[model samples]
Target: MTRPRLLINFAITADGKTSTVRKDPAHFTSKADLHRLLEIRKRADAILVGRGTLEADEMSLTIPAEHEPAKQPLRCVVSRGGSFDPGHKIFRSKGGAVHLLATDPRPDYDPAVYEKSGATVHTGALPDFLHRLRTEYVVETLLCEGGGSLVRALADLDAIDEINLTFAGHTLFGGQDAPTITGALGEHLPRSLEFELVRFDPQDNGECFLTYERKR
Candidate 1:
């Protein structure tokens, strides 16, 4: 419960699909929303994404020099299988630390695999994993740019302090297999978590940005 403040951000289609049924990177959100992402990124002490997001988006976790924080937030990723290509852009080009949170530490987990790629790998329970970011990395504010599963876990853990969602109004990626943020929360009655909407920006391009803060 003492983990750093977490913000979850994502973009979805009108049909509530974050991406196509193929699970590819989303390009449906407007450029202005992308700028909004960078603005949010500039304020965090660390940025986290699931390995799927990194692989699909081919993202570099740093911001422009003008927007970089004083210590530059670390580029973070969580991999259940602890496998990632050394050639990913975040490894080759991100401006600060590359930290990998591992869910499974097999005997064959070679430090060099993540190390040579510039990531300091971590393995532990989700809470302690996040606590390390706060204590060891000095990450006071962590931003999660999600792939649905990661968002679901954090939401299930009641770890998210805020949620930022963009509804890109022009398309629909409809598939019974695809779900939006907070994916599938197993068999249970609907869980009610209250959030106070803090901002709503609707653009002429049919993009709507909404921010919600968990009620304490």
Candidate 2:
């Protein structure tokens, strides 16, 4: 079970929703929170996200100058199918090497288009891909920024090591179909994994930042 040390970061509304039913970009947090995110990003060897999150956030996946990061983290995206848009912000931006993990490749999918755009595509199940990141890429710390289903998959695998959360109490996206950190409203995880809160920072702007480490 060798893999990178996994960390997940998310911002949730007062009602515990990550996004609206329409799955809009998560821009409701403050400038401070954005700074917080970049600060946290500075600690990772690589940053990962589901393809939907990468597109929805329009993320460049690069460490900005303000952060004065020692180095830009490798930008990684995972998609069930091999479909990826070469025009996405991550592809256009200058960052550490880009990697695409296609857990399920379709017969019609071609990896060349993505390879031409300067990405290395890997095909496998999630756990195997994660192992490759650890052994082949030397990724010691892997940070996962999410779209709920991806997070849910990691949860099912019990691969998450640390959880970072921003609780935005000022906003609420209330809808039965809205998604939470793990995903859609119903159904429990295969089993319970316990974590203990290790950090809690309450800001004046009605946002609270919390960190939890798995209680293994």
Best by lDDT: 2
lDDT of each: 0.82, 0.92
Candidate 1 has a TM-score of 0.93
**Deviating ranges (above 4 Å) for candidate 1:** 66-71, 184-190
Per-residue CA lDDT of model 2 for 1-216, tens digit only, reads 899999999999999999999999999999888898898899999999999898888988888997799999899899998778878877778898999998888888899988998899999999998899999999999999998999999999999999999999999999999999998977899999999999999999999999999998
Whole-model alpha-carbon lDDT for candidate 2: 0.92
How far is 196's C-alpha from truth in model 2 (Å)?
Answer: 0.4
TM-score of candidate 2 against the unseen true structure = 0.98
Worst 10 residues of 2 by lDDT: 82-91
TM per candidate: 0.93, 0.98
Clash-forming residue pairs, model 1? none
